[model samples]
Target chain A: MHGQPRPYWNPLVAGLILGLALLATFLVTGHGLGASGLSARLTAALGSWILPEATAANAYLGGYVKAGAPLAGWITWEVLGVVLGGLIGSLTSRRFRPKVEGGPRLTPARRLTYAFVGGALVGFGARLARGCTSGLGLSGSATLAVAGFVFLIAFFAAGFLTMRLARGAWT
Target chain B: MSFPFYDSGFWPALALGVLFGLALEGAGFASARKLTAQFTLRDFSVFKVMFTAVIVAATGLWLAEELGLMAPRSVFIPTLYAWAIAVGGALIGAGFAIGGYCPGTSAVGLASGRWDALVFIVGMIAGAAVFAWGFDAISPLYWAAPGPKGQTLDQLLGLPVPAILVAMIAVAAGGFWLGSRLERRFGGPIGSSDVTCGSEGAQPPETGTRPGSMRPS
Candidate 1:
């Protein structure tokens, strides 16, 4: 049972905290945030377990396979912390309700389908770029990496253009 | 000037990860609606937070190096892979438009107990598997268009760090100004479903409680 939920923090305020968090990560870990790498590692590990011969021969998955344990990297541990933090934030703020979130117009099945399809595209793209929004989009751009800016523009442009598709069924 | 403390181990990683998560959840990113609102022009929180965070981080990073408090190149710098990221980021964007959740946000959404977020994660894993399967074909493009390692925008443009950063700030300010106008025009904050729920994990569903100012009827 969820109680009254608090409003979200103002964007700038939250952004400050986020920036500090990222800065703290750099000062402490010599790197920035990441998310998609975990998926890659997981997939590679699963492949290694399920089809060792074939997976190990894979050009990308093999690199991960040879890279030792999937969870050995620092990003994995950080991402675990992120998951825990999310739960803690939700519980404390009374925002922790277990439900499939979709707008009124969307059916649960359709939302879930959208989620899966979208997630797949994001996963593939993030891996191709060697990072996702948090990884390359935020961290890289902050460091002024040229690819980061390039990624930023490309990502947002594509998103705005295709957003109508997402809401098409809703209308 | 590497910081020896960073070598201490996973404790920092774990602790920092928690902080990152708290910031994201606290920012109201745990909900898919909040994320997608920016795309719809109903809410600009994503753009606001993104620009501010990146600017602050870039400034902080530069200051730390300037003050010699942080090690030179202590943080990981993203490499330049022009085509790979160009193509890949577009895909990610398209996915975001459709899914309304990125990899990190999906994690937060999952923590909030959304089944869709879980499905998203599963899809992500499957998608990664697809990339792994086709790595041979993709590897050529992925490896192509390599730029110098650790190339900064300042270096690329032959400008000082401060100049580039300041210019970015100006650009962001302009974008922010424009974004506010867009929000005003759209008339929205398109509240998510069950933004205000009763005592139940699964609240009764409906069209969002607060529709945007000009949502297509």
Candidate 2:
């Protein structure tokens, strides 16, 4: 139901555009971009709804709940926009074919499993670091924050090492 | 209007998020294989895009502050937790290598109809829940070391802001130059063929198909 996929924009060009967006965000909002916070907030909110006692008693989830309504928070709205933007881009570019994407070495199930585990690790890691790529890697580092650079270096080094070990997953 | 307009300016934040997502998808980051290619040194889009964005945004922020266009301390600086952040970052990196999509790109991939990305998002939520439950164990280290919120790189390195900026710019430019060279030598060819999302026989693009490279040619 789609035509051939379009070629992606050049990396530098895309980066420049993205950088402008980040700058605009900083100029207007006085905060850098973020993504993983959404997951933490949602988890906190949903957990409290399902197990108010347990969630509130839990140190991490409890703090998130006290912060504000999860759905109405700043990053929540931003992430909603992220989904919408990607949807629009995919639709216009004709790249919206729904399927399990993976390297030649894996089956759909395997790919999905790896994706889930990887996502889980990132989720926990982001929470621990108090931010993710957009927050710590880009925004934090952009501000020249010490923590931001630490995260960037640590994550890249760990990622390369893990990728080497899991060569079978993609190679 | 005012700086740090989170309460009064959610609309703007949402708009910026869209632009961010669009840029990532346009860069082919909606594709997991395309993203993971960075680890293999087969593609450098991730490095190129990230550093470019950093350099541009950081420089712009510095200039704006200097010009008094934006109020100082308007931007929220993350607090420093040395041990927790380092360990957390390592975990995140391992996750990135395995998952291919980070939180933002996973959302983009899901938007583009990738079920794997959806699963990954779900996994993230579950992981967060686990972290919550395990907070007691991690809390000690999480709170072990803390720095003032405005712990910028210049302060950390004992270098002035301008010097750090200059260093960052040079490093990013050099990385881009090096990345292209690596891609030329070790990278898998970017595909011009029709991308198939088929089952069993389908392969993600730009993954090595050679003895150890990208997709089937």
Candidate 3:
């Protein structure tokens, strides 16, 4: 397996591990997993950094500021852990490499642009919905939250419906 | 009050997050191509992993509650902000199709050294800032009602938690079966065969492959 990344784990096996991890999260924190919330907080912190008065004056950013140090939140630390974990997994699997991922038809620049635009959309939408795939779909659904199911359905539906427009980028 | 773990501080959260990230990367979710394949209907790994995880967690949570290990009320559940969630979900879906990475997976991708993932993260932060700046204007849409507070499937359907969990497991099983069939029909080798891990400055890989030929077991 030298110079070759190991094949991905069986989906069921990986999912089982993930499920147990989520169970652990619930049992310990009385809360589910999340990703976007930390991003939102980081963004608010950035806002406050550049423009303190306005950031504190804005309703949304201000709320985060009032909550104390944005990076001090548990979710922020969790996200940091995620990055570390990913690094460990990639290193062990020998998949760590700096590269742009895109279809042959997509130039590296175009792919990067699309990634940024897509990320922005995700950021905005997650805040609007108050969560993302992890928060609303995985965590919420696991706990039988109605919003989780609704989000799961709506998310896939929208993805399927609009995928054609972006087909070239991936396909 | 049934569980005293929340008071244990941030270490537990961090450790769980690490596990979550490891699971995601181990499942090949660090690859943008693999993730986007779900939208293309060419691969079902995304659906498979997600549904399985959901079912497993849901079952475990339900079992814990039944055994009196934890109170259902102690778990944080999102309140239903119906229209906002629907609209937001749609936007997220579109982003997923376009970007091929979500907040969680993007972090993994970035860790695995994907340059695009870093750009995506920056974009995400900018988008969040835009939302913050426009919160007052968008509050109505974001906070739209017809929203019930903390509604769960069991409560909504007037069914027992176990019954709901059973239904969810059934759905997951059905989904997995269908996903396998789809993979057989549409799956192919990911991108170009020349593309390998840890190859920086490599050219973009060619798209698609002969259906049913390169499906990973």
lDDT of each: 0.82, 0.82, 0.83
List DockQ for all candidates. Answer: 0.69, 0.73, 0.74
Off by over 4 Å in 2: B1-8, B189-202, B205-217
lDDT of 3 by residue, B39-102 (tens): 8777777888888888888898887877888876678888889888999999999998888788
Q: Candidate 3 lDDT, tens digit per residue, A1-171?
A: 337677788889989998898888888888888999988888888888989889889888888888878778888878988998899998988877788887667778899899999999999999999999999999999888999999999999999877877877776
List where candidate 3 sits over 4 angstroms from the true fold.
B189-198, B201-204, B207-217
Residue B189 accuracy (lDDT) in model 2: 27
Worst 10 residues of 1 chain A by lDDT: A162-171
State the lDDT of candidate 1 residue by residue for B14-126, as single tens digits.
Answer: 88889888888888888876688788876788888888888988899999888888866767898888899999999999998888789999998888777878998999998
DockQ of 1: 0.69
TM-score of chain B of 2: 0.86
Interface DockQ of candidate 3: 0.74
Q: Which 10 residues in a row give candidate 1 chain B its minimum summed lDDT?
A: B198-207
Which has the greatest DockQ? 3
Candidate 2 residue-wise lDDT, A25-66, digit = tens: 887777888999999988988897999889877877777667
Higher-scoring candidate on DockQ, 2 or 3: 3
Q: Each candidate's interface RMSD, rounded to one decimal? A: 2.1, 1.8, 1.7
Question: What's the residue-level lDDT of A160 in candidate 3?
Answer: 83
